[model samples]
Target: MTRSLIVIFTAIVLDAVGIGLIFPILPSLLKDITHAANVLPTIGAMTALYALMQFIFAPVLGALSDRLGRRPVLLISLAGAAVNYLFLAFAPNLTLLFIGRAIAGLTSANISVATAYITDISPEEKRARRFGLFNAMFGLGFIIGPVLGGVLGDHWLRLPFIAAAVLNGANLLLAVFILPESRPGSRETIDLAALNPLKPLRSVLEVKSLLPIVILFFIFSATGEAYGTCWALWGSDAFHWNGLSIGLSLGAFGVCQTFAQALLPGPAVKLLGERAAILVGVAGVSVALTVMAFAGQGWMIFAIMPVFTLGGIGVPALQSLATRQVDENSQGQFQGVLASAVSLASIVAPLGFSSLYFLFREEWPGAIWLSVVAVYALAVPLVLGLRPKAAERASTSRRRGAPENSSGDASGETADLTFRHPRA
Candidate 1:
């Protein structure tokens, strides 16, 4: 990896670490703040508040990056995160906590910008592997962050946020020193109307060829985030696990995920190809969530993680496919659309899943997992149907003398045709 890649990888890790660091402790902290019989709903609302902010602001920041540059947006986000975590660390009431989380969410479009940075440097063909690398760093950070949060939080619940603040601070400083601007030409004037998060999504969804994958992304995002919103709480409720145990379990989950994301996608794509690999991944996610719903024992949960980890293949493949749908100049906007999709998921799913978990704690503790299974399963047939069409497109491109092993980028003549293709 180049120095820039390494720094960005670290940035990815830092972002995940900040998030994971809070997961093990946030529930209990929220419980203290609300003093309610059921804290799950309140926690869900808090998460939703954050996600709502993300949904509103992600496209705004993403468009700004397209106009200004990725570096400034990233740096501003890092600084905002550092401040937000500090605010969360000291928050005395739920209102302040909510405010802090909203601020954090507003600035959290950094990931989308970072992804655009990746697109700026990588060829389209290698993007899946590159995205996998980003996920690997994400998983690694999740491992370290949650473990430390759970362990340290056993003593002081506030410690994890402080740690997160420190990490973000460090990341900010490192980025200041090493991070390079990745946006190509600066837009002289950005369209204020173009910054609406919903508009870009509407446009992307209108593209007939992009519809299936976009739907797949939306469903998967909703289900995936719903699971995340409840994972720590579910363990605490179902297994009566403590913060330490929750951290360890999540850390171990991260380990399994990291291994899969770092190692599996490349080989899987090379063998089964990207489309098939995505099918395998989505199908595997459905199976894993189904199994997780039925896991009566905690150890059974551990046993199921590797199977769950296979779902990691879906994202890189999906991302790689999306990259081919747009011109290189619009990569930032494309990634912003993706982040907006995820942010939209984060907005609704947290509240929905958390409500289900809290409501059915006695009747069905694993209710949220069932929802997850259903969503992933729903996307499966759609994507499976998506395969033949993608294959046909590839076949057509090859017949037209598009490079089979060509450096899939936007500069060449073939790329211009790709940019102008009716489906594109």
Candidate 2:
């Protein structure tokens, strides 16, 4: 692989591994620290805030990467994560836990930058495939991190954070040595407004095609995150699983997720194309959640986990499609916008599901999640039907028939007519 791709891949792995090691241990740790019996809501709030900060700040971070270069932005993010991990590892109180999570949220610009980095180095024809590969690496981290965290955490709750910090620090060293710069434009005077943390919202409104895609992204991303947001507590509550069991189960989920990411997207894309791939992946998530809702044992989830995971195919495919809506010069902005949308969903889903859990019971929350799944499924047709804008259509037409505004091919001459066709 190229230097930039390697850097990004390593960076993602480091991030995921760090996260994996900590996540399974966090709920139990929090419960111990705060002495709060029902900690999922708090956990949901932290996750929502994390997503919210990312949603709000992603644009600014992306824009900064555009001006300052991806390398610098990446270093800053990693360093921030290191500090956040240190705080988590040493937290003396629940407030400290909240603060550390909040810091991680505000500074978690790695994915946004990674998206920018992949777009920076990838060839046009290979972009989607490369993104799929990168996403798979990320999924692998999730797979391994939790299991390790769970195993290590059983010995000591704070151990995962120490491990996460070490990995992030190593990532920091790797970036310092190996990563190359990949921003598309020259630095301009930094715009203070762009860094306002709410800047992604303005960008979201600016891009018309981006709006629907963002909503879809929210539902899709929410499903994956919801599982993470609640799984540890859920496992503890329903199955009487310990931290080790929770970690192992998450590890299993991660393994299936890794498999999906590693192998699923390319074939799924080949079979369904981007939109259809997203549909199938979302379907998998929906089915998986529904299965879990009714599932009586951890073994059942293990049986069908891979089948339902579909995460490998879903997130990257949608992100690739979202990436296509803008030109290279604006990738950071678009990604920032999408990240923000994901942040909105992150906030809504966990809190929403947690509330449902509290209000009704664990079983009922399954129905609510199924509703989320259904809503996501409903969006597939709309996404599939989106047409390139008139300008894009015209440009494509010209490319195919440069010499004669109309190629002699009957198909070429007739294509513009398709554009003129009425939208029912």
Candidate 3:
């Protein structure tokens, strides 16, 4: 791999490691600090805070990277994460935990920048494959972080955060020394107007070709967020699980996700054949979620987590498909929009599912899942019907141009953007 790809991969691994290390430990830690009987609402509130931060700042950071370039933004984000981990490691109370998480959420757009960087350096034909590598790094981080966390938890609950901080600090040093500025020095001055979320939405809205994919992103994000929001609570109610069991269940999901991300992308693209892969992913998740809600025994619950993770089969494929829609310069912009959409879903899903939990906790404690399944079912048709030839052609034309500086903004545009399918 080229130095640029190495840097991008390093950034992604560190970011994922940070997230994976902390997430599994959060519920137990918060429970201890807050003395709350129902940790579900607390988790929901924390998730909502994280999502809201992402919703508000992701585009701004993406645009900032576009103007200022990917390297600086990445460094800043990583540095912020290191500090956040420190806060989490030493927090005296639950409020500090929330503060730490809120900071982490706002600054944890390293994947966004890395996606833009890959678009910066990769050719269109190889974009999907490169993204597969990105996903693989994420999988490795997921697998390693939790196992490491579990071992460390035996010593001290705060050990994971300390480890995460060390990893981020090391990454920051490596990045400062090795990563080059992927964006050109002659790029457009950062435009404050483009930083406004509405302008990007308007730009995307006017492009008829991108609307369906945008909708697909929104739905996909919402469903995924819903699953994350309710999974632990549902498992606890169903199996009388404590934090350790919940962590194990999530660890199982992470393990499956790791394997699937590593092994499935190539075959999935070939088996489901691109478009069909997206369709299958949405449908698969819906089925798995419905089954999970009804899962009765411990063994059954164990089986469902991995099966549910199988729904992730389409993520890299759908992102690759989306890449077929836009050109090189707009990849970051498009990606920024997609990330924003996911953040929006992140914003909505927890609150919505929390409402479901409150309403149906007595009657049907699993009601939150019904909404998740419904969202996926709705996405099936919307994504499948999209046959965007024009977008594909536009993307092809730009690939032929071979835009320079994979992570840099154009001469007149300031906002750096990355789409899941950053190839276009």
Candidate 4:
């Protein structure tokens, strides 16, 4: 609605497009580069390398944004992304491609900064709805990205990278002129210790109550990596689909996910509560995955997408709840920590899932989805064990009655950070 929000959402869309652009074509590209029959492991390794960079830098950029303001960090990351895509476009060897991917990962760490920016500007009541739209914008980008990548890749393997570079270049310009700083940098001297990527993770871990949420983020993110790592390969193996078909399937999934995320998260949370909403989503995804695992024809995959899309409703709700777990000043740092958790998962999950898929590729390519369903199952107990909003309110009340800590950190007094309940 606001110009700032529009700009932020547009940036997210472009970023997602840049990411999705390579998905449909990555396997083929790797095969071309390595001249190997099995490029699955290479794909996994490359993805893990990308995530490894994000794991190390996401918090650094997020903390920097907290210190230097969100706008400058976003601008720098966007510029880096544009440059990295260009490098990827012209990369002649596997080593160069990996270099470009690592750079892209570093730039992709801006996601933490962007989430912090949104948290900075949105009121608590509006955060869930806004996060939903945030995901929707990303979904919309995926809708465009895979299709375009598939089409362009059919013509030339390098074209998608060029297109992505141009999109990110435009995204950089948009941010330069249109996006405003949501929060100003602190005037205090920069604490070099705070820039340590592990510092935020350690700080959050010291707060024991925060651990489950972090792990939940890890599990959710890990499950998500399987899709990006295996989707195109599975499509080709299972259905004999080409780049265009793979892209179309992904685009269709994106369309369904975008609509569901944009429209469902707020209502789902309102009606079922955050915990229950998450369970519903997990259930929906599990069912869809089961069907996918046993699907006889490609048409079945399309038919099950609506059910698959229901899986997205949980994340925005979870994000809205996670925001409640910390005070305003700590939001950027906390978000950075969460992004780090996600990056860590991304690093590990792709390798694990890709290996599992490699094993299953000969006999049952569809079995990979079963592995995802198993991972999804791991989150249920964690979700059920989460502190409810009422419990968080009670914790906040208790913290209010306690003496303030000498460090002036509002969350420092308790392991569970002070929670602010949104106005009804």
Q: By lDDT, who's the top model here?
A: 4
Top candidate by TM-score = 4
- lDDT score at residue 4, model 4, on the 0-100 scale: 84
> How far in Å is the alpha carbon of 49 misplaced in model 2?
3.7
Instruction: Output candidate 2 Cα RMSD.
Output: 5.6
Residue-wise C-alpha lDDT for candidate 4, range 247-334, written one tens digit per residue? 7787788889899999999888767767888899899999999999999899999999999988988889789778767766667778
Clashing residue pairs for model 1: none
Per-residue lDDT of 1-424 in model 1, one digit per residue for the tens? 8877887898788777776677778888888887777887777677677777877777777777878888888889989989998998999998998898888788776778888888887865567898888888987987787777888899998888888889889888988998888765475688778887887777765666666766777787788676567888889888888877776677677788898898888777767877888888987877878887877888888888889899888888777776666665566776777787888887777767777788888887887788777767788778776633333445456558765533343233233222224354
lDDT of each: 0.76, 0.70, 0.71, 0.83
Q: What's the number of clashes in each of the models?
A: 0, 4, 11, 0
Task: Please state every model's RMSD to the true fold in angstroms.
Answer: 3.8, 5.6, 5.6, 5.2
Worst 10 residues of 2 by lDDT: 415-424
Candidate 4, superposed: residue stretches over 4 Å from native: 25-42, 154-156, 233-245, 358-365, 390-415, 418-424
Sorted on TM-score, highest at the top, how do the candidates line up? Answer: 4, 1, 2, 3
Candidates' TM-scores? 0.85, 0.81, 0.80, 0.86
**How much does candidate 4 score in TM-score?**
0.86
Native-to-model Cα distance after best TM-score fit, residue 93 in candidate 4, in Å: 4.2
lDDT of 2 at 319: 67
